[model samples]
Target: MAGSRRGSRSSKKTADRKDKNSLLGRWLRRLIVAGVVVGLLGALALGTAVYFAERSLPSYSALMNSENGQTIVMRARDGTEIVSLGPSYGEWLYSDEIPQVMKDAMVSVEDRRFYSHIGVDPLGLLRAVWVAVRDDQRAEATSTITQQLARNIFLNSNRTMDRKLREAVLAMALEWKFSKDQILELYLNKVYFGGGAYGIDSASRKFFSHSARQLSTGEAAIIAGLVKAPSRYAPSADVNAAVARANVVLSQMRKYGALRADEAASVDVSAVKLKKESGGNSIRYFTDWALPQLDTLLADSDSREPIQVWTTIDIAKQKSATAAIKANAPKGAQGALVSLDRDGAVLAMVGGTDYVESNYNRAVSAVRQPGSAWKLFVYLAALEAGYTPDDRVVDEPTTIGNWSPHNSGGSYAGEIDVRSAFAYSKNTVAAQLGNDVGFGTVASMARRMGITTPISTYPSMVLGTSEVRVIDMARAFGEISAGGESVEPYGITKVETAKGRVLYRREPQRGHQLVPDYVAAGITDLLQTAVATGTGRAAQIGRPVAGKTGTTNSSKDGWFVGFSSGITTAVWMGRDDAKPVAGLYGGTAPARAFASYMRYAVKDRPVEQFDTDLQLPQWQLEPDDEYFYGDPNDYYFIDEQGNLVEPSGGADNGTKSPFPPERQEQSPADQPRRPSRDNETDDSAPSAASDDFLERAIGGSLENGSTRSNRPQQRSPSSESEMDTGRSWRSNPPEGIIERPD
Candidate 1:
C-alpha cells in the first residue's frame, strides 16, 4: 500500500512542474511582442521629426551661395569710397589657400571629431547629453563643425528642439552634397567675425591688418576663438579677453597633437597686434539716406552679389559742410545743411553736428516751421501775379479776419515800394499780398517751387507758419537758381554690380519750366535787394547772394535759404524739441552759417549774376513821419544831432517831431543813390544807402553797410532780445556778414 501511494504523489508533482513551465513560455512571448511595438513607435517618431525638418531646408544652391545680408559699396562723385554698407567680404579663399595652422586651431577648438563623423556625431552627442544631465543643464547637440556651418548658413539662433532637429538634418545634407574639405572651406569663409567682417580673410585683415595667408599660430588661435562669441572675443573689443580665449584654443591644439608644448608656449599673447580704429565720419548719414534709394533702383534684380554705387556727393564739399556746421552751430543747439546743384543733385548734406552722437537725419526728415523764409513763396506768388519790385504795398499794421499782423519793431513805413517792404520783411505787406492774390495761389506757388510738404491755407501760412523740410527748401531755392525750372533732388548717379554689370544709370534730365523767366527774375531781384540793403544784410559774402532770413515766434526755429554760383543751400538751427533759444534769430546764426559755408563752397566757382531788369525804388522819409529811437516808443526820439531826447508831450498828442525836417531836405545828389539798372553790372558794389540813412532805418550806425559801429548808446528791447520776434528791426546789424574788399 505505501509503494502505491508514493507512485501517485510522484505523478502529481510532475504535472505541477509542466503547468509552471507552460505559464513561463506564454509570458515571454507577450513581452517579445510588446518590445517590437515599442521599437516601431520610436522609429516612426524619429522619421516624422526628420521629414518635417527636411521640409525647411534651403536648396543646395542657396545653401552654397548664401549671403546673410545685402552688400553695398558707396562711392563719392570723385570715385572715392565714402562708406560700405552691410557685411564686408574679402576674396574667397580655397581650403588649400587657408593656412594649416588656422584650420588646425579652428578644428581643435570647435569640433575635435569633425573629420571622423558623418555630419552628426553619435558618440559626441551621447557624451554631450550625458555631460548636460550630469551638470543639470540643457543638452548642446550639434557641437560639430559641419553642424555649426549648417546653423550659420541655413538657420537662425533658436534653441527649440524643432530647430535642433532641422540643424541636424541640414548638417547631414551638407555633408552628402559636398566633400569634407569643401564644407570646411565654406564654414571658414561664411562665418561672421566682428566689425562687419564675414570671412576669415576679412577678419584677418580687419583685426590684424594682414591677410589669412600670413597668419601665425597666435593669430590663428585668436581668429579661431572668435567663433564662440565674435563681439565678445574680438581683439578690437577686449584684447585681454581675446588673448585668454586664444590661450584656451592653443591648449586644445596642443592636446589634439596640432602643436608641440614648446611651439604652443612660443606664442606671445602680449605681442598680438590690432588695427587702429578710425574716428566715426558723418558719411554714414549720406549712406543711410541713399540705401533705400538703392533698394528701389535695384528692386528688379534678384542677384545677391555685392553692388557698387556711384553717388553725386562731392567729398570736398561734404567735408566743408561738416566743418562749417561744427564751427557755427551754437552750443546746446542742433543744425542741419543741404546743398544742391542747379539740376538738384545733392552735393553735400550735413544732418547734424556729429553723426556719431545722433543718426536722425534732420536735413531730409525733420520738418519745422520756416518762419519768414516762407515769404519766398508768398513773394513769388505776388511776382507771378504781375506785381513788380517797384509796385506799391502798405507796411502798416493790418488785420485779416480775427488775426492782426504787425512789423518786427511795431514801426510802420506807410505806402512803401514792394522792394523795400520785402527787403525789410514787412509781415503786413506779405499778409495783404496773400489775401489779395489768395493763399491757395501762394500754396500752389510753393509746390511749383519744389516744396513737397503739406501746405496750410490759413492767413498765418503766408508768414511761414507752415512746416517744411530742409531738403525741400533747398530744392525750392534750386528752382530759382535753375532759371525757373522744376528741380528734383537726387544722389545716386550710377549703380553697378562688383562685376561691372550695370543695373541703373541716371540719365541727364532737363526739368520743365515751372515759372516764367520774368517772374523768377523779379523774385531774384527782391532777394538781391534783401541781401544787398535789407535784413538779409547778414548773408552778404562778397558775392551777389539772394536769400531771406526767417525767425519763428519765441525764437524756436531759425533758417536761411539762399543760392549763389549755381548752388542752392539751406541752413536751419533750432532745438530738436522745439524749445525757444534765448537769443536765437535767423539773421544771427543761420545767415552767418550760410555765409561761412558758401564762402568756402563758392571760392573756386565763377561769380554768377541774377538776370533781372527791375530797378530798386528810392526810399524817402515823409515830412510828417517821426524818427523815434530807443525802442520806437513815445518816450524817446532821435534829435537832429543823433541824440535820444524825451518829448515834452506824449507821442499821441501831436508833438512836433524832434527836428529831422532838414535831414529829409538833402538834395538827391547828396543822398546816397542806388545804381541804375542800366549801369549796375555788379550787384556786390557798395550799397547806395548812406550810413546816416542806415542809422535812422535800422536804429544803428554802419561802416560800409557791412560792419556795425558807433551805434546810439540806448538800445531797443527788441534789439536786446536779438530781434527774436520774427526778424524785427534791431539796433545792431546781423552778425557774420563780412564783405570782402575789392
Candidate 2:
C-alpha cells in the first residue's frame, strides 16, 4: 500500500513538471512570433516612407541627355574669331573608345569604389553624414560617380535635403537603367571642364588640343580634377591651382592602384600642354587686355549664353603696332605702346616687344615715372590757375627750401614765356609753377585727365616723379585730344551670341567736360610747340603733330605721349629693372617709336589742326635789370670792312684809335667827369691802378703772386666759420643731374 502511494505522488510530480515545461515553451513561441511581427511592421513602415519619398522625386528623363550645341565664337570688329569659347562636341565616345588609363585616373580621383557600390555609397554617405554633423551642416556632400552624374544631368546644384534625396533616388534609377559603362559615359560626357568646355571630348580638344581617346594619364588626371570647380582650376584662370589639383588627382590615382607609385610620381603639370588660343599669338595679348572689361560688360548685361566680343582692334593695325615694337625696340629693353581714338577707343596696343618671349603687358601693367610727359598736367593746372602760355616766369636759379632745380641743359634762361618753358621742359620753371599753383591742384588736374594712379604733393611730381601706367597716360593725353572730355577708354563695341543674337550692344561712352574747350585748345597749342620746334622735334609728322617727350633721371624711363585729331598714342621704353639705359632719352628712342607707330597708324587719317582760339590773358615781356647787356659804349661795332671799331667815347682821346673810333670820349662840349670814389686819384680819369683793380674784379684775375689785397685779407675765424656754415646747405650736384625725362 505504501509503494502504490509513493508511485502516484511521483506521477503527479512528473505531470506538474511537464505542464510547467509546456507553458514555458508556448510563452517562448508567442514571444518569438510577436518579435517577428514587430520587425515586419517596422519594415513596412520604412518601405512605405521610402516609396512616398521616391514618388515625390524628380523624373530622370534627361539624366543621359548631355548634348551641347555649337561652340561660342568671339569676333573682332571685322567679324573674325579672336577667341572661341566652349568646346567642339566631338562624337559621343563609348566607354571602350576612351583611354583605359583616363578612365582609371578619373575613377581614382572622383569615385574610388565605382565598381562595388550599388548607386549610393552607404559607407561614404555615413561618413559624410558624420562629417556634416561634426562640422557645419553645409559641408561638401560625399557624392558618388553615379550620384554626380544624376545631379549634373537631371538637376541644378542647389544643396538642399530635397535635392540630395532626389539625387540619391535618381542615382539608383540611373544604375538600374544603364550599365556601369553607360553611366560612366554619361558622366564623362556631361562634366564641365572649364574654359567653357563641357565633357571629355571638348575638354580634351580645348586643353590638350587632341581627342579624348589620345589623352595621356597626366592629361586625364588634370581634366578629371577640373570637375570640382572648373572656373577656379581653369588653366587660363590659375595654372598653379589647376596643377595642384592635378597632383592631388595623381596621388589618388597612385593610392587606388590605377598607376604605379613611380609612374604617378613621374607625372607633373608640364605633361599637360594646353591648346593655343585660336586668334594666334599675335592677338593673344589684345584678347587678354580686353578680358577683364568683357567680364564687367557681361556682368552688366542680361545675357547668359557665351558671347562674341566685337572689339575695336584692327588686326592689321595690331600687327603693325606689334611689328613696330619688335623692329624698333632696343635689345634687352621693354617697350609698350598704346594707340587710341579721340573718343578713347583702344585701337591698338603692344605691351611688350615680343609676346612670345614675355606676356607681361607693359602697355597696361607697367608703371614708371612719366618724366616730362607728366608736365602736361602741371601746365594744365597753371592754365586753370589763371596763368597763360604767354605769361613769363623767371627761368633763373630759384631756391625753395634746400631743393634748387636746374635746367636739364645746365644753363638758366633769364626769363621765358610759359609756352617756351613747357616746350623746352625746363625743370626749374615747372617746379616753380608747381609750387605756384600748388602741387595738389596739379594732381587734381591729372586725375581729371584720367591718371588714376596716386599722385604725390611733392614739387617733384611736376616732373612726373609719381609713377603712372602707360594706359592711364595714354588716356590722359586722349582727354586733351577729345576736346577736354574725360576719357573712358574702351575696347569692345558689341557682344553677341554665337548665333548672332545680340547680348550687349555698347553705347558710346559720353564723358563730362572736365576742362573747358578753350582751355583744352590752349594746352593742345602749347603741346604742339613741344613737337613742332622744341625737344619733341623727333616726333614731327608732315602735318600738324603735338606731343611731349619724357626722360626720367638716370634715363631709367623714356616716354613720348602725342596726339593727332584722330588718335592719341603713348610710347614707353625702359629696362625691366630700373637700370639706366645708357644715353637713352625720351626725345630719342620713345619719340622714334611713337613716330614709327603713328606713321603707319595714321597714314590714312586726315591731318587735322587743333583749335587755337582760346581767349587767354595777354602777357607782356618784362625787362629784367639783372639780365641787361653791358654798357653799349664799351661794346664794339663791326665796320663795313668787317673790322672791330670802338666808339670814340673814351676817357683819353689823345690815344688815337688804330681802327676809326665812332666818337671821341672827350666831347668838345662835355666837361671833365668828377671822380666817383675817394680812391680815384684825378678827376680827368681814373689812374691805371684803379682801372687794373676794376678789370681784375670784372674779369677773372690770374692766379699769380700779386694779390688784390697785398696779403690774403685776414678774417676773424668766426667769419670764416660763418661762411662755411652757409655753404652746408649747398650740396654737390649728383653725378648725373636729376633731370626730368622730357
Candidate 3:
C-alpha cells in the first residue's frame, strides 16, 4: 500500500512539473512575438519618416548652389570697398583643389570615423547612448560629415527629435547619392565660418587674405576650429580664443596620426597672419548708415542676386573724421560728426569715437539739446522779420513770463547791436528774438531748414532746449550753404548687381526753395561774421567759414555746425548719460574738432567766398579780444534820417555822439540791470509761468523801455498769430551801437 501511494504522489509531481514548464514556454513565445511587433512598428515609423524627409529634401543641384545669405558689398564713391554687409563668399573649389591639411584637420576634429561610417556611425552612437545612460546626461551628438552637409543645405538649426530624425535620413540619402570626396567638397563649400563669411574659400581669404590651397597646418587648424562655434572662435572676434581652439584641433590631428606629434608641436600659431582693412571697424558706421537707405532704394525691386551699393561716402574723408574724433574727443566723453555737400550728399560720418566699443550711432540716431546751435533758426526767423544784422537790440537782463535767460559769463552788454549779440551767443538776445518773431515762426523756420525733429513752441526752445540730431544740424546748415534751397541728406547713389545691371539709380531732383534768396544771404552773412569774430573763432581755417557755436546748460552738450567751401559739417560732444562735462563749451572741443576735420576735408577743394549783396556794419576788434568793449571805431550811431552811420570822430575825437542827449553816458541805474552771477540759470529751462505764456509773449517785449522815433520799422509777422501789436524794447539806448563794418 505504501509503494502504491508513493507512485501516485510521484505521478502528481510529474504533472505539476509539466504544467510549470508549459506556462514558462507560453510566456517566452508571447514575449518573442511582442518584441517582433515592436521592432516592425519601429521599422515602419522610421521608414515613413525617411520617406517624407526624403521627399522634402532639396535637389542635388540646389544643394550645390545653396548660399548662406545675400551678400551686399558697399563701395565708396571712389569704388573702394568700405564694408560687406552680408555673408561673403568665394569661388567654389573641388575636393582636389582644397588643401589636404585643411581636409585632414576638419576630419580629425569633427569626426574621426568619417571615412568608415556609411552615413551614421553606429558604434559612436551606441557609445554616446551608453555614456549618457551611465552618466545620467544628455546624449552627445556623433554626426558624420555627411550629416553636417545635410543639415547645412536643407535643415534649420533645431534640436528636436523630429529634426534629428530628418537629419539622419537626409544624411543617409547624401551618403547614398555621393562619394565621400564629393560630400566633403560640398561640405567644405557650404559651411559658415562667421564674420559674415561662408565656405572654406571665403574663410581662408577673409582671415588670411589668401586662397584655401595655401593654408598651412596652423591656418588649417584655426579654420577647422571655427566650425564648432564660428562667432566665438573667429580670429577677428578674438584671436586668443581662436588660437586655443586651434591647439585642440592640433591635438585631435595628432591623435588621428594625420599630423606627427613633433610636427603638430612645431606648428606656430603666432605665425598665422590676419587680414585687416585700412580704416578698421570705424568705416562700419558709414556702411551702417547707408544700408537702410539701400533697403529702401531696393524695396520695390524683386531681384535676389548679390548686390553692389555705390554710396556717396568718401573713404579718405571718413578716415580723417574718425582720426579727428579719436584724437580730439575729450576723455570720458563721446563725439559724433557728419559731413555733407551743398547738394546734401553724405561725405563722411563718425558716429562715435570707436565703433567696436559701441555701435550706437550718435550722428543720425541720437538726439540731444543743440544748445545755442539751435539759435541758427532763431536768427533766420529774425532775418525773415526784416531785421538787419546791424539792428540795435538790448542785451540787458530780460524776462519772458517767469523765464529769465542769462549769458554764458553772466556779463551783459547793456545795449548791443544784433550782430555782436549773436556772435557772442547772448542768451538774452536769443530769448527776446524768439519772443518777438513768435515761437511758431521759429519752428516753421527750423522745419524749412531741414530740421525734422518735433519743435515745441516753448519760450526756452529758442535757446536750443529741444533735442535735435547731428545729421539734421548738418542738413540745416547745408541748406544755407546751398543758397536757400532745401537740403535732403542722402548716402546711397546707386545699387546694382554683381553683373553691373543697374537695379536702382538715384535721380537728381531739383531742390525747392525753402527760404528766400535774400533771407539765405542775410543768414549766411551773420554766420560768416560769427565764425570770423565770434564764439566760433576757433573753427577758422584761413578760409570763409560760416557756423555757430552751441553749449547747453551745464555743458551737457557741445556743438559746432559750420559750412566752408560748399561743405557743411556738424560736430557734437557730450556724455551718453547726459551728465555735465567740466569746462565743456561749444567753442572749445567741438570747434577744435571741426577745425581739425575741416582742415583735411576742405584741403582739396577751392576756396569760395560767400555771395551776399547786403552791406554789414563795420565792427573791428583785435584778434585777442573776444568781446566788444565799446570801441569808438566799431560803433554805429543812428543818423538824423534813421539810417545807421559809423562813428565819425573815431577814438581820438571827443565829438558829441549822434544820439539823444539824455542817453549819453548813462549810469548803471538808468540801464537794465544784469542778473546776479550766483543766481544764473540755464537758458533752456522753461518758465514756471502758464503754458500759454509763449503764445502771449509773441510779438511783444516784457521789458520796460521807451521806444525811439528812429527805431527801424518792424516787418509784419508771417501769420496772424505773430502780429506785432507791442512796441520794441530799447532800454537806455547807448550813444553809439557796436557793429561790424563791411
Candidate 4:
C-alpha cells in the first residue's frame, strides 16, 4: 500500500512539469508573430512616405517635349557637322528611327529585365546590394532604364540613400505616365554621349559622321556602350577602348539572342570609320557663301526658328582643296578653288586664302579674265560650226580688224590640226578660228554652256579677255565631265526645322544638253591629249585627265580648269590688286595645285576611264604619217562615218583598224555592180557615179540634226545596220582645211 502511493505522487509531478513547458512554448510563438507584424507595418509605412515625398518634388510636363535649345546646325553630305549657329542642339529622332540592333544592345547591356520591370526591380536591387557588400564596391548601381531616365532629366544624380529613394519614386511615376518606348526615347536623347553630345543623333554626327538612322551595328554598339562612362570610352578620345566596350555590348547582345553568333563574329570594328573631332575654327567660306542663300531657299516658309541646313559640301575634299591652294600659292597672292561633281553639286569651295581676314568670296564673286581657259568656249563654237578635230588650221600670225594676235614667244606652227592648236594653246590659231566662227556665235555658245557673265564679242575675247567667275568655269567643265549635260552648281540641299518639319527642299531639275555627244567626245580627246603631252602635262595624275592651262597677257592671272569622270575643279591664282606675279603661268603653280588636290581627292575612288574612245580615225591621215596609222589586218567592221572600227574583242588589242582595206586594188570597171530593174526610172535606180553611190550607201543629208540622248549610245561594231543609217562620209573635206605642214 505505501509503494503504490509513492508511484502516484511521482506521476502527478511529471505531468505538471510537461504542462508548464507546453504553455511557455505557446507564449514564445505568439510574441514572435507580433514582432513580425510590426516589422511589416513599418516597411509599408516607409515605402508610402517615400512615394509621396517624391511626388511633391517637381512636375515633369514641361520637360517632356522641351527642346534643349534653338540652333541651326549645318551638316555635310555624310552628316558631318560643318558648323552650327547659336547653341549646339543636335538632330532629334523618333523612337522608331533608332536601329533595332542599337535598341537591343542598350537593353541587353544596360537593363536586361527592362520590359518586365515596373519602374523599380526588387530582385535586381537585392542582388545589387549583395554584390556591393560582398565586393566592397560603393559605386554599384542597380537602376533600370526608367530609373536612369528619371535621374537624367527629372532628379539630380547622387549616391545617397535619400537620393536613391527619390530616384525610385520618380521612376515609378514615369512608368505610369509614359510607355516603354517613350521612356527609352527620353533616356537616349537625355543621356550624355561625350564630346559635348547630348543625344544619339549628336553623338552619331560627332563620332561616326552619320545620322542615328544610318548608324551601322558596330557604330550603334560603340555609341550605346558610351553610356557607361562617356568620357572614359569616347571614340575620339581612345578608339581602342571604345572598340573594346563595343565588343562587350555586342557579346551581351548575342548572349540575349538579340544578335546571332555569326553576326557578332562578322562585325568589323575597324571598318567603323570615325571622324576625329578637331580643335580650332574651320575655314567658313563655304558656310558663309551658303548662309546668304537661306532667304531664297526658305522664302516660302514662315518659321524664323533656327533651321538645319543639309549641304553637298564634302569636308574632306574641302580641306584638301584648301591645303592645296595654301601650299602652292605665293605668299601675298590670293587663290581660290571650286570643286564640283558631275551633277554640279559643289563638293568643295575655298573663296579666299583666309576667310577670317577677308570674307570676300573670290570663287563666286570675283570675275577675272580666264586667259586661255576662255579659249574652250571658242573651240566649242568652232566644233558646233561643223569643224572636225583633224581639220588643219594655220597658226601663223593673223591680223583681224586691226588686231594681230601672236602666239606666246612669237612661236607658231605653220600648219597644224585644231587638236594640236588647242593642245599647244596657240593664240594666233584660236583668234583665227574665233574670227572664222564669228565672235557673236562664240559668245552665244559661252552663254549656252554655263557662262552667265556678260561677254564682249571681240577677237581679244577669244584669248579670254572677258571676265568670268571660277565657279562658272567649273560648271561649264562639269557639263563636259558629265558628257555634254549642262549643270547649275548648287550647295545647300535643303533646310529643316528642329522638329523635322520641312522648311524648304530643293527639287531636282533635269539638265539640258548644251554640247552634242560627238562634239563633247572630240573635245574630251583633245583636252586629254593636252593634259597628257601639252602645256598641262605638269597636272598629270597617272590617269586619264582632261584639262587646260591659262595665263593672261601680263601674267596677272593664272588658271587651270580640269576634270575627271568623278569631279571637276578650277584653280585660280593671282594678286588681289590685279598686279602681275613674276612667273605665274597656268601650267606651273595652278596645275601643280590641281594635281596636288586631285591626287588626294581620287585616292579612294576607282580608276574610271574617260567617256570617249581614243583610237577612232577622226583625223585625215597623210601618206607620210606613220605614227597615226591603224591595224593593217582589221577588215570586218566600220564606224558610222565610214572609218574603220576597232572591236574590243579578239586578239587585236587597242589598235585601230587601217583606213582602207588592201582588197580594194581593182579598177572601177572591175568592181561588182548592182543589178537594176528595167522598169525603174534612171533617178530611182541606184547610182553608178562614185559621189552618188557613196551618198546613197552612207545615207547622207545636207543638214543633219541628230541629237544624242543623255545616256551614251552603244558603239559596238556588231550593230552595222544601225551605224549605216546614221553615218555621213564627206567626199571632200570642209572648206577651212590648210593642208601644208610647215
Candidate 5:
C-alpha cells in the first residue's frame, strides 16, 4: 500500500513539468504571430502612402472649360428650324431651380452627415469593412454624398484601390476648394437623370414639359428617386420600380425630419408622373435623316460629340410628304417617302408615314424589287443603246434564261414603239430590251448613280428585278435630276467637342458624271408623256411634274417615283410580310401620294427643265396642228424632267377606243391580264359575224394593225365558249396592314 502511494506522487510531478513546457511553447508561438501581423500592417500603410504619392494628378479642365460645342440644327433653305440638339438640352442651375422638397429628399437619401464629413469618413469605412467581412459578402453602403459627387462628375465608376484612393483625394480637394453649399449645388447640378437629360432643368422639362422651378412634393419625390438609378427609376418606364424608389426616398425624408411619417404615407405614389415621355416620341426625323449618313461617315469615332448637321432637308416638304402618305396609304400599311434636291441633297425623308410610331427606317433599310420601276432603268439602257422611242419591238411572249416574262395582260402585243412601250409599262418589251442591253451595264450605270446593291445580270433586272432601298432609288433619281453631278447625300455637317473644338464636318465631293445631259432630257420627255396620258396620269399636279408608276407582279409592291426642279420624291407602299394588296396600283396609291406631296413641295420653287442636250429616239410626232386641235389632255404624258411625248400605237392601239391600246393590259405582272372571271371571254365571240371584224384586226404584223400568229388564241377578250382556265385568285392584305411600297 505504501509503495503504490509513492508511485502516484512521482507521476504527478512529471505531468506538471510537461504542462509547463507546453505553456511556454504556446507563448512563444503567439509572440511570433503578433510580430508578423504588426509588420504586415506597417508595410501595407507605407505602400498605400507611396502609391498615392507616385500617382499622376487629375486634369478636369475639360469639364471646367465652358466652350459649348456645336449643336445640330436642321433647317430649310430659308433657315426655318426643323430641329435642334444640345448636350441634352441642359445648363446647370443651383438652389434657384431646385425646390425645397427636392433638396430635402436628396440629402435624406444620399447623406445623413453630409455637413460634418471631411473628405474621409473613418466611421463609414469601418462600417463598410465590417459588412464586407461578415460572412464574406460584398459591402454595399460605403460612399457619402461628397464621394458620390466626386465620382459622378470627375471620376469614372470603377472598383480598384487606386480608384478609391483617387476618390478620397478628389473629395478632400473638393472640400478644400468649396463650401458645403457650393459643393451641394455642383453635385445637385451634375448628377444624371437619364432620358438624354443631364441637369434638373432639362429633366424637369423632359418629364413635365415644364421648368424645374415648379414642382409639387410628390413630383419632387419621384424626381429625387431617380438619383438611385436613373434608368431603372424612370416613372413611366418602370412603374413598379418607380413606386418602390419613391417610397424609399419618402421614407428617408421622414427619417431625416424633412417630412412626417403620416404625411409621407398619405402621398399618392401614382402621382409621380414622368417628365420625359416614352418611345421614339419626337426627334424621329433626326434619326431618320441622320442615321444613314452617320453609318457611312462616322468612320472611327463613336457618336459621343455634339454635332452640327447642315442638311438640305426642308421641314415643310417632309410634313407635306408624310401627310400625302397617310392620306393615300391604307390603314395599318407601312410607307416610305424620300425627296431630294436637284443637287442630290436629300430634302425630305419620312421613313415611315409617322416616324414616331415606327423606327425601322424603312426608307433606307427596306430592300425590295422595284417591279415596273426596274423597267425604267431598262428603258434608259435601251435608249442609250441606239434604240429610238418610235422603234418597234415585239411585246410577244419572250424567255430570258429559264424565266419567261408575261405582260400584265396575258395576251401579248406584236409590236410597239419604245415611247408607247414604256408609257404603257410593257413588261415583255422591257424584258426583251433587258436581254439585249446586258444587265451588267444597267447595273453599272445604276451603281454610278448611287444604287448600292448586288445587281445580277438576270433578265428580270429589266422589270426592276434587282432589290433596292427607297433611299438608294431617291439617290439615283436625284442624280438624274442633278444632270449627272454625282452628289452623295449627306446629313451631318459637323461634330465638335464640348469645348467648341471641331471634331468633324461633312464635305461630300462630286464623284463621276452618270449620264449625258441630253440623254436625261430625252428620257424625261418620255416620262412626262407617260404621266400625262399613260399609267402615271394620276401623278400630275397643277405645276410641271414628272414621275413613273411601278406595280410589281401580283401588285405586291407599289411605287411612284417623281421629281420637281427643287426635289425628287419617291413613295413606296407595301406589306412588310411580302403579301399582295388587291386592286392596288402604283397610279392609284403611290402616284396620288406624289401629287399630294407636290402640292406643298413646289412652293416658291421655279419649274425648271432638266438641262439635257441629247435628242430623243424617233417618237411619233403629234403635229402642232393635230396636238393643238385636239384636247391637250388627249396624248401628252409628263416625264421625269417635266416634258411630254406621244405613245407608240401597235395593231391594238391603232384601233382607237378612247383608252390607249395597252390600257387594257395593266394589272399584276405575274400572269397575263384577261377579262374578269365572271365576264371572262370564251373560245367564241358573242356572234359568228363578229369574227370577220376580228380577222381584219388580226391579219398581218401587229404594227400593220394585224396579228400574224395565234396571239388572240391565248387570252382574246373577244372569245365566247367558256371553260375553267385554271386562273388563281390573288388578294391584298387587310387595309390597316398595308403600307405604300412603290
Candidate 6:
C-alpha cells in the first residue's frame, strides 16, 4: 500500500516539471519573434534612407553646361574638324544623324529592348538576376540607351560599386531630363567610329563621299558596327572584324524585324562601296601647318573655344600632290610636298605619303640634310662676291672638310663655266665655292631668307650637310621668289567665331631684305639653269623656272625645291627612320614628283611667265676675251705657288692658269671697280666692255647686273703665308668658307 502511494506522487512531480519547461520555451519564442520584427523594420528604414539620400543630392549637372563650354566646327582649311581631341583614334556620330538602318542595326545588336526600358530594364535585370542567382555569379548592367549615354558622358569605365551607383543615378536623372530620342542622339554622337571620323557626317563623307543622310542599309549598318570598336572594325585595318561586326548587326536587325532573314543573309558589307582615299583626309596634311597657327592665334591659352580658320590650301592641289606621291613613291619610302606662293601663301601641303599610316608630319616636321641643293645658297653667295655664270671653275677633285664629296661621275674633268658646273651638279665645284665665300655669309643669307633651321658650314655643308625641313626649304626658295623679301608661310588667313565675330587675322610675318635684289636675281638665274640644263632637267616646263635638287650623303634624303612666278614648291623623299633608299637620287625621284605636280597644278591656269624673266635679261653666250683660253676642252689659271694650272672648277672656283702665280697688281686705271686686294678672285665687277655679257649672266643685279666673266683666278702673295695651308683660298679652303665681298 505504501509503494503505490510513492509511485503516484513521483508521476505527479514529473508531470508538473514537464508543464513548467513547456511554458518557459513558449515565452522565449515570443521574445525572439518580437526582436526579429524590430530588426526587419530597421533594415527597411535604413535602405530607404540611403536610396533617398543619394537620389536627391546631386554631384554633377553638366549635361547642358558641358555643351555650352565646348563647340564643334569644321574649319574652311580643307573642311577639317576643329574640335577637342577625345580618347579614340577615330570619330563618332550622333544617333539622330546616323542612318535609320544604322541606328536599327546598332540598337538591334547592342540593346534590342533599349526603347522599351526606362533607364533600367526590369525584365532584363530580372532575367540577369535569375541566371546569376542560379549560377551564383554577379549581375552587371541591364542598361538602356539612356543609361549607356549616361555612362559614356558622366562616368568612367569602372565596375566599382561607387561608379555603378553614380551611373545609375545619372541615368535616372538623364531619363527625367531627356526623352528617348534625345538620349539616343547623344549616345550616337559620342560613340567613336574608327578611322579618324568623329560624327556620322564626317564618317559618311570620309567613307562614301556622301552625307550620312544618304547612307545605304549595308553601308549604314557597317558604319554603325564600327562604333563598338572603331579600330577593330575598320576596313583598312581589319576587314574580317568589320564583316563580323556587320554580321552581328545584321543578325540582330533580323531578330528585331528590321530586316528579313533572306535580306540579312544577302547583305554584303564587303561589297559596300568604299573609297580608297578617305574624303577630306587631305585635312590631315594641314595638321602641320594649321596646329601651330592655331596655337599662335589662340595664344595656347584659349584654344578650347570654337574658332574658324580660313586657309589658302587648294583642295585640288593638295589632292593632286598627294596622289602623285602615293602612286610614285617607292615601296617603304615616304615623302612630303609643300607648295607656296611668292607671297608666302601655303597653297598645298602633303605631310606624308599616307597620314593613315603615320601622323608624324614630315613636310614641316622632318629635318634632313639638303645635299647639293644647298649649293644654291653658295652660288648666291658667289654672286654677291661678283662671280658670274661664265666664270671658270675646275671640276677637279676637292676636299672641303673631313668629307671628300665627289662629282656625279666620280672623276674630275678640266675647267667649266659656273653655269655648266651647277647644271651638271658638281659637288667638288660647290665645295670650292664654299672656300671662296665665308660660310657665315651663306648661313646669314639663309637666315635672312626665312630659313629658321640653324645653318652650320662643314666642308660638306656646301653639299647640304646641314639638316632642314621641307617648309624651311620652301621658305628659303620663297625668299628668292618674294623678290628678296622674307616671308613666313601663311596658313590661317583669318579666324572667326561661329557667331560671326572676328577673332584674329594672320599678319604674315615678313623679314627685312635677306639678300640684295640683284644678287638674289643672279642666284635665281643659276637655279634656272639648274632646271633648264642642269640636274633638275626634268623640272623644265613651258614657262621660266628655277629650282635645285638635293641628295643627302648616303642617298637617304632626296629633295627638289624650286620656284616660278606664282608658285614655289619643295619636294622631299626619304625614309622616316633615315634609312638609305634603293639607289635613289634627288634628280630622278623628287625631281619627277615636282615636275608632275607642277605640270598638273598649272595645267588649268592661264600661262603665267616667270616674274623675274622680265626683270633680268635673256641669257647670251658672249665672245671669249682675248685673255680667255683658246682650248674649248680646258682653261688655265695661276696656282698659289705660281705654277701653271689648267682650269679645273666648273665656273668660278677652279681656274687653271698657264702662269702659276695670280696677277694681283694694280689694274689699268680705266677699270670700273678695283679688284679685291687679296686677288684670289678678280670678280669685284666686270670690265665696262663685258657689261652686256654680265647682264646675260645668271644673276642680274647686286652683281648689280655685271657682265659675265670667265676670268682665271689671280693668286695673291700673302694668301700662301698669312693663311694655313688647310685654310688657303687656292690650295686650302676655309672650314666655313662662303662668299667673298664685291
Q: Each candidate's TM vs. the true structure?
A: 0.55, 0.62, 0.57, 0.51, 0.53, 0.54
Q: List lDDT for all candidates, in order.
A: 0.78, 0.73, 0.79, 0.75, 0.65, 0.67
Residues 1-742, model 3: lDDT tens digits: 9999999999999999999999999999999999999999998987776667667666667777877767888899999887777877898888889989999999999988999887778998999999999999999987888888878777766778887877888887777667899889898888889867788999999899999988999999999999999867888767888899999999999999999989999998877888864445677778777786765787787666899999899988988898888887888999999999878999999999987656668998899999999999999988766566766677778899999987777767766667777777888889988887788999999988878788889899999988999999999999989888988899988899999999999899799988777778888888887787778888999899999999998888989999999999999999999999887888888998999989999999999999765542222211111233665565444333223343554222444344521112223333322211212232323222211222233334434432322333223244655443211212222333232110
lDDT of 1: 0.78
Mark the regions of model 5 whose C-alpha exceeds 4 Å error after superposition: 1-74, 88-195, 198-283, 286-288, 291-309, 492-511, 609-742
**Residue lDDT tens for model 1, 3-73:** 99999999999999989888998898889889989989977876665566556666645665667666789
- Per-residue lDDT tens digits for candidate 6, residues 1-742, read 8999999999999999999999998988988888899999976874564456436633333442243123434354566543333322123344555577867876886678877775666788799899999999987566666666677665656678787666766676666656777667666655556554655666676677777778887877877788677656776555667778888788789988999889888888888877666433545667445755655676634544565666777777778888877776777999899999768888788888877655567888788888888887888777666666656677776765567777764656556667667766777888777777777877776666666687896566677877888998898888887767776787777777767777777675657787777667777777887787667877776777789888876778888889875689998999988999886678877888888888877776676554433132122112232234345444534333323344454323455433332222223443333223224344554332333322333235325332334445322234545545423332222222221100
Residue runs of model 2 more than 4 Å from their true location after superposition: 1-85, 90-197, 205-209, 221-264, 268-281, 289-309, 354-362, 365-368, 394-414, 495-503, 552-556, 574-584, 617-741
lDDT, candidate 2, 420-485, per-residue tens = 778778888888888877889999998888887788987778888999999999998888888888
RMSD values for the candidates in order, in angstroms, are 18.7, 18.6, 16.0, 27.1, 16.5, 18.1
Rank list by TM-score = 2, 3, 1, 6, 5, 4
